[model samples]
Target: MLLGRHPCWRQNPAFPAIKASTFRLRRLPSSNPSLRFAAGDREPRSFAAEEMGKPKQYWLLKTEPGEWSWDDQVASDGGVAEWDGVKNKQAQKNLKSMRLRDLCLFYHSGAKARRVVGVVEVARQWYEEGDGGHGGGGDGAVDVRVVGEMRRHVELAELKGDGALKGFALLRQPRLSVVPVAADVWERICELGGGYEGDGGDADDGDGEG
Candidate 1:
């Protein structure tokens, strides 16, 4: 991940200041590079259990409009629905690991423009929904419910343009479909989502992120 130019600030004359808290997930030495799961495997651990008996981790889930829309989730018989059809090994891993109460950032992809539209909560644990693509079965899946929508759509361009999101994994690993959201990143995004008061333009009251 490279730090590109910020339109708001000019290049400094001296050495640039680097944020000391930036995190990077190091790849473990392995013979294989692929992160997908093999046939007949179970889902990952529950993310909800990882936090204070509450879902603290944040995540982003991408779905095409033609397939499933945010409105579909909201209009469902109940707010909760199963999240399936995840074939990618890594994405499966993320879904399996998600806790029932985890927060998800709903994104619309494969369209004219990509944007994060709403927030959803994980409602069920990872379980094998049905027969996977292979003759085998037990693919990982999750259940989610639409919690709320962003006041303004957070476009990919805006996400790429934000200086505050320089270290976000969503920007760093765009193709990772499902990714972890650090606590700091989660709070920052909540702040970005209009401070969770339905007000999109209010500045933080000097309370810092979260």
Candidate 2:
């Protein structure tokens, strides 16, 4: 099936619009800083899980900002977009396991920015997105919406320094794009981030990017 256009968005321009150009889905962006998400607003992951009687899950998603930055995600279509492009077998397995309300940490991979900058939730469960005209099978994908951002970005160095996170999946499986996050570890990271896990939800905290 042809997937929606995934915006190959950027940040140096500051909140550029994300409109799907091809089978890859892109998101819509807003330049307004006043735009706020009330949790109840937009796509709620729990609604689907609640109706289907499925439990929530946690995970971490890593992406190189050169393709799309945190600002691109936040600005993308009211914080919602399809998280496509997983070709790795291991990572695709992780994506398939995601259920509604499954929370994920948005990790900015690559040398310049290696940190957890925000949190997103599964808006749509895993679905087969046939090659969008690409010769490859195109693997699979899922829809994710911005739930919130880390007011205080969590650095990879900090995560490595903390003895408590020794067994973190991201640490053990650095190459995996979709790594699961344990509940306790999730709390630990949030606590370490000054106890403000949902920074994007608060209008006063627009410092997630940078």
Give the top-scoring candidate (TM-score). Answer: 2
Model 1 TM-score is 0.63
Against the unseen true structure, what C-alpha lDDT does each candidate score? Answer: 0.72, 0.78
**Tens digit of lDDT per residue, candidate 1, span 48-116?**
434655636789998776667778877876877777878778888988888767788888877575888
Candidate 2 wrongly placed segments (more than 4 Å): 1-55, 131-137, 195-210
In terms of lDDT, the best-performing candidate is 2
lDDT, candidate 1, residue 37? 53
Determine which window of 10 residues in candidate 1 has minimal summed lDDT.
1-10
Q: C-alpha displacement of 25 in model 2, angstroms? A: 63
Candidate 2 residue 130 C-alpha distance from true site, Å: 3.3
* Residue 159 Cα positional deviation in candidate 1, in Å, after optimal superposition: 0.7
